[model samples]
Target: MDPIVEVVALILGFVGWVMVGVALPNRYWKVSTVDGSVITTSTIYENLWMSCATDSTGVHNCREFPSLLALNGYIQASRALMIAAILLGTFGLVGSLVGIKCSKAGGENYILKGRIAGTAGVLFILQGLCTMVSVSWYAFNITQDFFDPFYPGTKYEIGEGLYIGWCSSVLAIAGGVCLACSCKAGTKEKYPLRYHDRGTAYSGAAPSRSAAASTYERNAYV
Candidate 1:
C-alpha cells in the first residue's frame, strides 16, 4: 500500500469527525425555528400550565419552550457537516491516487488498486451531493426560509462561500484519485526477484574463482 493512501484515509477520518461531531447538528439548527414571543409561560414548582387569551377576552399569554437560537445553531452545524463531507471527498481523491500508484508499482495488482480508487470516486460523488445542498442553503437562506416559510425578512446567506468551498473539496478528491490511479498504471511491473525466480541469481551463483580456490586449497594442504 502506498503511504499516500494512509494519509488520505486519515484526512477522510477527520472529515467524518467534523461532520458527525459538529456540522450536521449545526445545519439542522440553522434551518429550523422554535416557537416563542407569542408563546410564554411562568412555571410553578412541580406544575406548569399554558393559557392564551383570545381577542374577545382581551388577555395575552406567552409560552416559552422552543428556542430560535437553538434552531439557528442547528443550521450552522449542518453547514459545518457539509464542509466536512466535502473535505472527506478530497481525501478520497488522495486515496485513489495512492491506489493507482500502488497498482503500477507492482506491489499490488491493478484490479485491486482500481477497486480502491473506485471507492474514492464514489465518496467524491457523495460529497458533491452534500456540497450542492449546502450551497443552496447558503444562497437562499434555506434555514431562515424553513423557520418562517412565508415571512419576508432580511437575512444573511453565505451561498457563494459555501459553493466555492464545496467545489474545491470535490476537485481535490477527484484529482487525487485520478493521479494515484495513473501513477499505479504507469509503474506496473512485476519484478523478476519476486515473480519468476532466477534461483542461482537470487540464491547466489557458484563462484567463478572455484578452480583457483581448489588449487590454493591443495597447496595449503601440501
Candidate 2:
C-alpha cells in the first residue's frame, strides 16, 4: 500500500471516530419548534440520551431520559447502534495502526499486515453502516414527526448533531474503501502477471510443437 494513502485513511478513520464520539453525548439531534419566531418563552433540544430546555433568560435545564428499556424503540436502537459503532471503530483503529505499512509494530510480515489492514477496513465499513443507519433512522422519525399534522406537540427541527453524524459516517466509509483498495493493490503487486505469462508461454509452445510434428508426419508420408 502507498504510505500516503494509508496515512490519509488512518487519519480520516480516526477523525471520524472522534466525531462520532462527540456527537453521541451531544443533545442537539432535534430542537423544539421549527419556527424561530415563536421564541416567546423557551426552546427544547433533544438527543438520543437526553433533552435540554433553554429559557428566554438563558437558563439551561437538562434532563436525562429513563432507562434503556423504558425508551422508545427508535431511541433505543439508535443508542445501541451508535455504541456498537464506537466499539467497532475503536478496534478498527488499532488494527489500522498496526497494519499500516508506515508503522513498525506489526513485525516484518507484510502479507499478514496487509490482511490485518483489510480486516480493519471491513470493520470500518461496518461501523460506518451502523452509524449511517442510526442517523438515518433518527432523521426519518424527526421528519415524520415534523410533518405529522395530527400530532399535538411542538415540531422539532433537525439539529447539529445529525449533521455531524452524517459527516462522520461519510468519512468512515471513505476511509474504509481507501484502505480496501490499498490492500487490493498490494495483492496485485505481489503476483503481477506471473501466472498469466506462464500460461501464455506454455500454450504457445504446445501449438508450435504440434505444428512441427504434423509437418514431419506429412514429409514422412510424402
Candidate 3:
C-alpha cells in the first residue's frame, strides 16, 4: 500500500471524527426563524441535547431537554445516529492507526495491514452515512415545518451544526473510499515471496562455478 495514500486517508478520517464530536454538542442545530415575527424579544435555538434563547440584548438562557422520549422523532433518531457515528469513528481511528503502511503497530505483513485499513475505511463510510442521515433528516423536518403555513409550532431554520455534520460526513466518506480501494493491494500477488524450484532458471543462477563443475561419481556396478 502507498504510504502517502494511507497518511492522507488517516488525516481525513481523524478530522472527520473530531468534527462529529464538535457538531454533537453544538447548541444551534436549529434556530427559530424570525421571518414572520413582528416583535422578536428573543431568538430560540436548540440541539439534540438542549434548548437555548438569546434576547435582543444578547443575554442567553439555556435548558436541557427534560425528557428523551418526549422529543420529536427526528431529534431522537439524530441523537442516536450521531452517537453511533462517533463510536464508529473511534473504532475507525484505531483501525487506521494499526493498518497504515507507515505505522509500526501491525508489523511488516502488508496484506493483513491492507485488510485492516480497508475495514477502517468501511467504518468511516458507516460513520459518514450515519451523520449524513441524521443531518439530512433533521433538515428535512425543519424545511417541512418552515414551509407549512398552518403549522402553529415554532418554525426553525437549519443551523450551523447541521452544516458541520454534512461537511464531516462528506470528508469521512471521501476518505473511506480512498482507503477501501487499497484492499486490492496484495490480491494480485500469487505469493509473498518467490520460491526457487530445482529445475527452474533460479537453480542455474544458484550454482557457483566450482559446484557446476563438480559431478557426483556413481559406484561401480557389481
Candidate 4:
C-alpha cells in the first residue's frame, strides 16, 4: 500500500470518528417561534439519549429521555446505528494503524498487512453507512416535524449536531475508499526471466541436424 494513501485514510477516519462522537451527545434541534426567531428565554437542545434546556441567564439543565424501549422507532433505530458505527470505527482505526506499512505491528509480511488494511477499510465503510443512515433518518424526521402544518407543538429548526453528523459520515466513507484503494496490487516490478528458461539459455548446446535442414529449407523458400 502506498504510504501516502494509508496516512490520508487514517487521518480522515480518525477525524470523522471524533466528529461523530461529538455530534452524538449534542442536541439536534432548537426550540423556536413560528417567526423563526430563537426563544432565548428558554432554549432547548436534544440528542438521542437526552434533552437539555438553557435559561436566559445561562443556567442549563438536562434530563435523560425515556428508556430505549419506549422511544419512537426512528429514534431507537438511529441510536442503535450510531452506537454501532462508533464501535466499528474504533476497531477499524486500530486495525488500520496496525496494518499500515509505516507501522511495525503487523510485522514484515506485506500480504498479511494488505489483508488487514483491506479489512479495516471494509469496517470503516460499514461504519460510514451506519452513521449516514442514522443521521439522514433523524434529519428527515426533523424536517417533517418542522413543516407539518397540523402540529401545534413548538417549532424546531435543524441543529448544528445534525450538520456535523452528515459531514462526519461523508468523511468516513471517503476515507474508507482511499484505504481500500491502497490494498490494490502494488507497482513493484516482477522478475522478467523465468528460472528454468535462464538455466536452459545458460547451458549452450550444438544445433541438431533437423534444425540445419529446416534453416536450409527456409533459405530456399525465401
- List TM-scores for all candidates, in order: 0.38, 0.86, 0.84, 0.81
CA lDDT of each candidate?
0.47, 0.89, 0.90, 0.83
Could you list the CA RMSD of all candidates, in the order they appear?
14.4, 3.5, 5.3, 5.0
lDDT of candidate 3 vs native?
0.90
lDDT of 1 at 90: 57
Residues 114-159, model 2: lDDT tens digits: 9999988888888889999999999999899888889777789889
What is the Cα-based lDDT of residue 157 in candidate 4? Answer: 70
lDDT (10s digit) by residue, model 1, range 1-222: 354653554354335334333333222222112234364332111001111222324554444335445554534554565656656665665655555543354356666665566566556556655655554555455445546656765222232334454554455444444444544543464464455567666445446467679889999999
lDDT of 2: 0.89
Q: Which candidate ranks first by TM-score, i.e. highest?
A: 2
Q: For model 4, how does the per-residue alpha-carbon lDDT over 4-89 read when each residue is reduced to its tens digit?
A: 99999999999989988988887754444446565457777777888888888999898998687888899899989999999999
- Candidate 1's C-alpha runs over 4 A off are 1-69, 73-77, 83-87, 101-106, 142-153, 157-159, 169-222
Q: 8-64, model 3: which lDDT tens digit per residue?
A: 888999999999999999999999998978999999999999999999999999999
Evaluation by lDDT, superior candidate among 1 and 4: 4
- Candidate 3: segments with Cα more than 4 A from true spot: 189-222
Better of 3 and 4 by lDDT: 3
Off by over 4 Å in 2: 34-39, 196-222
